[model samples]
Target: YRTKIVARSQNNKMHTIISWSIPLGNNILLSYIFAYGLGNHINITSILLPTIGILFIALGNYMPKTQRNRLVGIRIPTALNNDINWFKTQRIGGLMFVVGGFMMIGGGFLGMISEFWTIALMILPLVLITVVPIIYSIRSSHKA
Candidate 1:
């Protein structure tokens, strides 16, 4: 039964230790806990906003790579019916995703804005990002 403890250093590095000691209850292995600086405040919005931004960017890049299948990527009913519709929609959607992703990344920095403006900023981009692609996909299906 052993325990390991890792500590943060002055230069913001980690020190790893291998400890072998007495066994725990019922010969259980020792648990491990990694801790950052004490009293470190993490900003939730900062982490989430960039994560979502990166997701959109990744999705944008992925859209072009995916084949038209019911299981993955953007799966709209109308778009699903036609390959040409799917391809065009994906291309436009990919572009929108890239734009939307950048907008979300930019929104992550709006910590100083008023709540009203913040909501407006985020909502508008979201609607543009998602709704427009759906509309475009549906319309293209009609044309095909």
Candidate 2:
């Protein structure tokens, strides 16, 4: 399988792999190793790392650019019918996703709020982002 390392940021100091193979076993093994390394020092952040890693792996495989319209990707009907609308909606949605992710991640770090509340905050923005584009696409389509 093909593989490549991508650096997200200089400060982050972590590299993500773009891989064609399913590395579920490898991931589990790595998680175990990390957990063991942090034995007796386990904390919320340690737990969050694996959760975020899983999310990143899943998202990498199911990104909008890769799965345009099956079921998981954006599915605004009007946007699907019009390339320009599709591009615009996806770009906007992508930005919303990044922002929501950051908020959720920050909330995790803060550890003051309940996990459910943090998740809700992330979800609400995503839902709004999705709705806005769909509404705009429909309105624009009607005008055309």
Candidate 3:
């Protein structure tokens, strides 16, 4: 299904690049965390949380580069309707992603202090990242 979507999309190359990179990076980070964290008795959550944040940051950097397609990105209906909306949404979404990434990274550090804070930080940013972009995309679409 994904292959067909990418194959048909105008920016197939970027989609392909992102698809390959996301998994590869995730695997590498997970592998290292398990190998080193377990051996050294380091808290896996502490390391894993930050690693996930860094991944989000990398993804955020790529978000604006993506073109409208079903294979990757936010994929909201409003953004998908037109190129201008897609572009604006992607740019805003990218920023939100980066901010969320930083929040996650902070959550990693706070994980040592309180589980509640760690969970809150992690979830709140995720919600904002998703909801904010969709809202912006929808409102922007209405205006246009």
Candidate 4:
């Protein structure tokens, strides 16, 4: 992880990390405030699920811009070892995130009616975002 932290270029890694972090951090902070501080006044699921979706979309938008760094993007051995895999993985991962974001937003709405369906939709995206990129990185590395 220490080795991974070393910046490969003058791309201002901290800026990238900070750019990614701020929205996510704000979302989490607001979520906490909304969920706990005003839990009684607001519907937790309505705000939370959609906020999570926006975070996912924001992350997805940032993914392609992420260079190989310990702090962000898809960080698997195969992706980390090479630039090609890193970019491809990030691109696919970004797409997955965006797709997942939409599903999650839909889940926020659908959740009101069917909690089970919302959970099912939400879980599949989470699984795909985690698994697909790793698998793609591995397979792509093999091809090279």
lDDT of each: 0.61, 0.51, 0.81, 0.78
Off by over 4 Å in 2: 1-73, 112-117
**Could you tell me which residue pairs clash in candidate 3?**
none
Candidate 1 lDDT tens digits, 1-144: 111121122111111111111232113211211112444455445445555666677667767655666544567998778888888888888888888877777776773455554455567668877898899998888776
Candidate 3 wrong stretches, greater than 4 Å: 1-41
Displacement of the residue 9 alpha carbon in candidate 1, Å: 44
RMSD (Å) of each candidate, 1 decimal: 15.3, 8.5, 3.5, 3.6
Q: Which is superior by lDDT, 2 or 3?
A: 3
lDDT of 4 by residue, 1-144 (tens): 544545534335435655776787687768778767655465456666777787788788778777887667888999989998899999999999888988888888888888786787789879988998889899999999
Off by over 4 Å in 4: 1-42
Compute the lDDT for candidate 4: 0.78
- Can you tell me which runs of candidate 1 are displaced by over 4 Å? 1-38
> Who wins the lDDT comparison?
3
| Cα TM-score per model | 0.66, 0.50, 0.77, 0.76
Candidate 4 least-lDDT 10 residues: 5-14
Best by TM-score: 3
Best-to-worst order by lDDT is 3, 4, 1, 2
lDDT of 3 at 63: 85
Tally clashes: model 4: 0
lDDT per residue for candidate 2 within 79-105, as digits (tens), equals: 768766665666556555555555555
